[model samples]
Target: MNFPDLQTERLILNQLNEQDTSALFAIFSDKKVIQYYDIDAYQTESQAQQLIEFFNKRYLENLGIRWAIRLKENGQLIGTCGFNSLNEKMKHAGIGYELAANQWGYGYASEAISKIIELAFSSVSPFCELYRIQGDTMIGNEASEAVLKKLGFKEEGVRRSSGFWKGEFHDLKCFGLIKPEFKAL
Candidate 1:
């Protein structure tokens, strides 16, 4: 299937590429942005390049897609949002996202993620048969929790010490949205 580009009122979610390394690096290297990302802040552009390659690989393998979020107004890439894991046999996938510090508090993450959920649930040929999409955030990440809640994801439970980050294990608060829940929205 062809990689799709998702659009919202103020954002365009497109595939990431080499040209996006600098912009992505700028966002990923910021402490505020990566605070709850469960990964260390990038230390160089090469890491961003590696990330883009990883994203492309995932797409090529039909495992997931990580769209580079761009503001339509100025064409500035502000963040990314997409599936990070897929289980076709189980009809579920894991969702992940992060936004630039300057783009926070503007509802961009929610808008972008809502679109991804919409795509996940709609009958769009070979691309939309998922029955559930799950997301997890660091235990104390209230902002992420609020975003997931606003988009109709119900918090399931916490996975104690499930994620290793910052040289320690961190509890993950899991949220899930089933197909029925999404259809009822």
Candidate 2:
């Protein structure tokens, strides 16, 4: 079955394609945007092109879903969202995304993530008994922390020096939004 394109008040979430490379590069080349991200900023247009192809292959394998975050008003790609780390663990499938720095506070991330969370637990598969959305965010990313909280994630704790980035070990906030606790979100 095909997943219908998802729309929020100001954004659309859909799969990525070659046509989006330019726009992907536009946001990904900004070093600060990926500062807390695991993937590095694209060094050139070709890197972005390669990333677009990689995204396509992942979908072809049914191994993951990556949706381009587009501005509904202009149909422009501002970011990407969806699940990563799908496996038997059930603990790893998660909602992950990044947006153009300019679009940071407009509710786009939460809107798109909320949809993915709904789909993951309902339309995707084996939703019954699934209890939570486990997530991790770098210690200082207040923006991401806030979004997760808005989505009803509770911070259980933090892992000290769990990630090495920018030449230093960083703490990562651990969070979870379980099914029973998610009703109000």
Candidate 3:
């Protein structure tokens, strides 16, 4: 299947290719950007390339999809957002995203995410059957939490020691947006 490309008023959500390696690395390599992320800050361009390959592999296998978030005006890749895990039979998916630290506070994350949510809940989307989309944020990641809340995800409480990364387990705040809730937005 063709990779789906989505758009918002000021951003474009499209496939991540080799050409995006540098930009992708730049985002993931920033310590501030990955402070709340599960993975450590990328130290090499190969790490970023591997991530791109992993995302594409997930899409090819129908397990998930991640879009490169780019600026419409300059086509500069700023970050990525998409379902981290997708189970069509269960009608549920887990979402993930990250943005360049410099790009924070501009509502780009929210705008890009809103578009993804719309498609996930739309009848014409490949993800149309998805009934639930969830996100998990490390404790203290207020910025991410606010974005999720702004997009209509309800706080579903914290999962103690539910995530293990960066050499230790960390608590994760769960947020969920069901199709009904999304449609109501």
How do the predictions measure up, each by TM-score? 0.96, 0.87, 0.98
Task: Give the root-mean-square deviation of each candidate in angstroms.
Answer: 1.1, 2.5, 0.9
lDDT of 2 by residue, 1-185 (tens): 46447787778888787889888998899987998887778889888888878766766665666789898888999999876545444544665788998888788899988877776666344322345677789988889999999889899999999988667888899988877677665
Clashing pairs in 3: none
TM-score between model 3 and native: 0.98
lDDT digits (tens) for residues 71-170 of candidate 3: 9999999999999999888999999999998899999999999998888888888753799999999999999999999999999999999989999999
List clashing residue pairs in candidate 1. Answer: none
Off by over 4 Å in 2: 1-4, 88-92, 123-130
Residue 41, model 1: lDDT of: 89
Q: How many clashing residue pairs appear in each of the predictions shown?
A: 0, 0, 0
- In the range 1-185, model 1's lDDT, one tens digit per residue, is 67788899999988998999999999999999998877888999999999999998998888988899999998799999999988888999899999999889999999999998888888882453799999999978999999999998999999999989788999999999998988787
Which one is best on lDDT?
Answer: 3
Which is the winner by TM-score between candidate 2 and candidate 3?
Answer: 3
Q: lDDT (0-100) at residue 162 of candidate 3? A: 98
Local distance difference test scores for all models: 0.90, 0.78, 0.93
